[model samples]
Structures are given as C-alpha cells and as structure tokens.
Target: MKILLANPRGFCAGVNMAIQCLEECVRMFGDNIHVYHEIVHNKYVVERFTKLGVRFVDEVSDVPEGAILVYSAHGVSPAIRQQARDRKLQTIDATCPLVTKVHMEAIRYARQGYNIVLIGHEGHDEVVGTMGEAPESITLVDTPEDVEKLSFAPDAKLAYLTQTTLSVEEAGRLIAKLKERYPQIESPPKEDICYATTNRQHAVAQLTERADVVLVLGSQNSSNSQRLKEIAKSLGRPAYLIDGAGEIQEDWFTEDNNVLITAGASAPEVVVQEVVNYLKTTFNAELEEVVTREEHVTFPLPKELRQLQLSN
Candidate 1:
C-alpha cells in the first residue's frame, strides 16, 4: 500500500495567529481566559485548551464582567463586540484578516447603496459575521437555486462577496450564476476566499486524482475541511473526514489501494502524523508527499494581545 500525503495542509497562518493569541492569554491570565468561540474549529485544539481551564462561550453574557475574552479566528458581529464592551470585558480580536476583509467589503457596498449578495454557507460563523456587518443590505446565498430565487432587478445597483473559506469551484459556480442573472453585478475589489483555503483545496484535488481513497483530517464544523472532503468525493473518490487517527476504519481501505491524506486549515500537523503512523504500522504504507503549492503567509497577533504583551 502507498500513502500520498498532501503538502500545504494543516494550520494556516491565521489559525497559527489565533492559536498563539489564545496561548498567550492562557499564559498571562493563568487559564481563566474566555474565548468567544472555538479559537479554531478543530476539536482537539479546543479540548486541549479546555483542559487548561480556558472557557469557551457562545454569548458575551456567559463571560464574567472584566474578564479576558478572545474572539475566534472567525470574526464576530459588531453586536457581539458591543456586548463585550458593555460588560467591560478585556477583548482580543483574533479574527483572521481575510475574514475581516469580507466584512469591510460588506460595509463598503452597503454604504454605497448597493444591494449585496454574499456567497457562503448560511449559519457559518464567518458568514454570519460578514452578514452582520450590513445585515440590512446583504443577502446570503449558497447555491444556483438560491441565485435563481433572487428577485433583484437586473439594473439595480448590486455587488457580491464570498466567505474566506469556500471551495474555489463552488464559489466560482455561484459567482457565475450571479453574473448570469445580473450582468452588471460588481465583484469584491479582490477575491474574498483566503489564500490558505485555495492552496489546500488545490493540493487535495491534485492528490485525489491518484488516490483510491482519501482521508481528510478536520473537525466536522470546519468549512474548509468539509470542502476538501467534498472536492474528493466530487471526483468519484471515496473520502472520509476524520478528526484524528482513531476515526480510521480498516474496512475503508484495501491492500491494493493508494490512500491520500490531507488536513484542513485549522487541523494540527500532529494529528496528521498520528494518522500516518497508524497507516505505516498497519499497512506498511510507503509515504509520498505531493506538493501542489508552497505557502509562506504569516499574520501578526491581534493588536489587543500585542498591547497586553507590551504592558506586561
């Protein structure tokens, strides 16, 4: 058996920054930190932090007044920030810059009086936050069918943006549909899908071609991770999204199969190595890493965290 491991997989720059922000908070505050959401969507990461006394809460009210709160890599709505401020919580914004870019575009389009269409999965944290930027102007749509139902006049001033973690092919299809329906609809000044998402998806798509079965290491709620699994399945390969090595089922693989393993943007490399170790021990698999792209992107820690570091 052979293993085709994917390069450019696992924690992206934004995830790294967010995780670091949380780690610094824990170290400085001694584990009494409150996170607005899972710092990133990986279950292992969240569970590890929980073990260290970090608390994850969905609402601002859940956090004690004047406590330290870190926003997740997925940005939050302005209302959530206001609530934090109202309670005097010392907040660190760990929102990925790419996600923040979409929020800015939503605000800009709304201020310009353009009816905005946001291409993203409804109810996703990132999508919800971007829509909240200009809820009165932005309408969320994820499918061609959703586009078909839109009743905007063809000549009405219109603009579109996308979630930073969308599948490239899926976003392209949706954008095409929007353009087909509204010839004059404007796109974001730049593509809203983050570079990390595009690189990971492209790498997986290439590896899936030669793989008989594909394994994606990511949490179920991770949007980019889900997209990687879907991309493989779309190519007629058997793909499973697993959180770690323990989720692997022997029945899914055969001695003759070539397996491809990749991790999501928020997944840890340690989880990938665990899966690789399991495969090597069980199947004596020969590992080959397929590199589709090289990434060197880095994001700085959130300003609030940096200031806290400086004061300390």
Candidate 2:
C-alpha cells in the first residue's frame, strides 16, 4: 500500500489560537476553565481538555458564577457576550479573527441600510453567532434553492456575506445566482471563506484525484474537515472521517489501494502520525507527501497568559 499525506491538512491559525488560549487559561487560572462550546468542533481536542478538567457548556446559564468562561474560536453572537457579562463570569473571547471580520461586515452593512444576506449553513455555531450580529437585517441563505426563493424589493440596497468555512464551488454557484437575480446587489469586498480552509480543501481535492481512497482526519462536526471529505466523495472516491488511527476500518483499504490522508483544520498532526504508523505496521505502506499549500499563520496568545509566562 502507498500512503499520501497532504500538506496544510490540520491546525489553522484559529484552531491554534483557541487551543493555546485554553492551555494558557488552564495554566494561569488553573483547570476550572469553562468553554461555551466545543473549542473547535473536534471531539478529540475537547476530550483531551476534559481529562485535564476543562468544562464545556452549551449555555451561559450552566456556567458557575465568577468562573473563567471562554467563547469558542468559532465566535459567538453579541447576545452571548452580553449574557456572559450579565452572569458576571470572567470572560475570554477566543473568537477567530476571520470569523470576527464577517460579523463586523454584517453590522456595517446593516447600519448602512443594506439588507444583509449571509451564505452559510443555518444553525451552525459560527452562523448562529454571526446571525445574531444583525438579526433584524440579515437573512440566511444556504443553497441555490434558497437563492431562488429569495424575494425582496428590487430597489432595496443589499449586500452579501459568507461563513468562514464553506465549499468554494457551492458558494460561487450561489453567488452567481444571486448576481443574476439582483444585478445591483453588493457583495462582500472579499470572500469570507478563510484562506486556510480554501487552501486545505484544494490540497485534499488534489490528493484525492490520484488516490484510490481518501481518508480525512477530523472530528465528525468539524465543518472544514467534513467539507474535505465531501469534496472527495463528490468525485465518486471513497472517503472517511476518522477520529484517530483506532477508528480506521481495515475494510476500507484493500491490499493494493493507494490512500490519501488529510486532516481537518481542527485535527491534530499527532493523530495523523498515529494513523500512518498503524498503516505501516498493518499493510507495509510506503509514504509519499503531497504538498498543495504551506501555512505560516499564527495568532498571539491571550494577554493574561503572556504576562504569566513573562513573570515566570
């Protein structure tokens, strides 16, 4: 068997910042950390933190008063931030900078009298939080079907925004439809799909082209990772989302299969190593790395943690 490891597969700047924030929070404040949601929608990351005493909650009401509460990197609605303030919880905002950009655009466009249209999956954590930014002005559209159903005053000033992680092709198709319907509508100055997500998806797509089977290393709920898997599956290639090496079903690999391996933005590289090691032992696989993208993005750690490190 031959194994292909994709470049730029896991751990984007946002996920890196989020994980660092949690580590810093634990070190500075001790393990009584309360995160608003799964830090990055990856079960492995969350489970590892849980073992270290990090508390994960879906609602602000469940958080203990005066505890250190964190918003996930996926970002949160303004309402959520207000709720944390009302509860008197010590708060840390770990929202990804890119997601924050989209939220800001929603606010700016709404205030400028433009009706807002957001392209993202409804109910997604990021979408839900972003929607909260201009709830009265924004309408969510996920598909071409939704675009077709869109009905608004022809003369209404309008603008569009997008979720940070989305299928580029799908979003393009929708944008084209929107343009056709409202030739005068305004679009975001830039696409909201982050560079990391786009680069990783492109890498996964490239690797899957020559690979007999593609394996995506990501949590089930990771939007970027799931999109990578779908990109492969959409091409009629076999794909799977494995939490780790232990979840790799042997049945998916035949004796001569060439496997392509890619990790989601939230997945850790250590898991990829484990998967490769497992395949090496079981099938005597030879490894070849395919580089589609290189990433050097980094976000600074929270100030409180940085100060502690300096003091230490």
**How high is the CA lDDT of each candidate model?**
0.93, 0.89
Q: Which regions in candidate 2 have their CA more than 4 angstroms from the true location?
A: 303-312
> What is the per-residue lDDT of model 2 for residues 110-142, given as tens digits with 9 covering 90 to 100?
899999989999889999999999899999999
Models 1 onward score TM values of: 0.99, 0.96
Model 1 stretches with alpha carbons more than 4 Å out: none
lDDT (10s digit) by residue, model 1, range 1-312: 899999999999999999998888899999889998788999999999999999999989999999988999999999999999999998999999998988888998999999999999989999988888889999889999999999998799999999999999999999999998899999987899999999999998888989999999999999999999999999999999999999999999998789999999999999999999999999899999988899999999999888889999
RMSD of each: 0.7, 1.5
lDDT of 2 at 307: 67
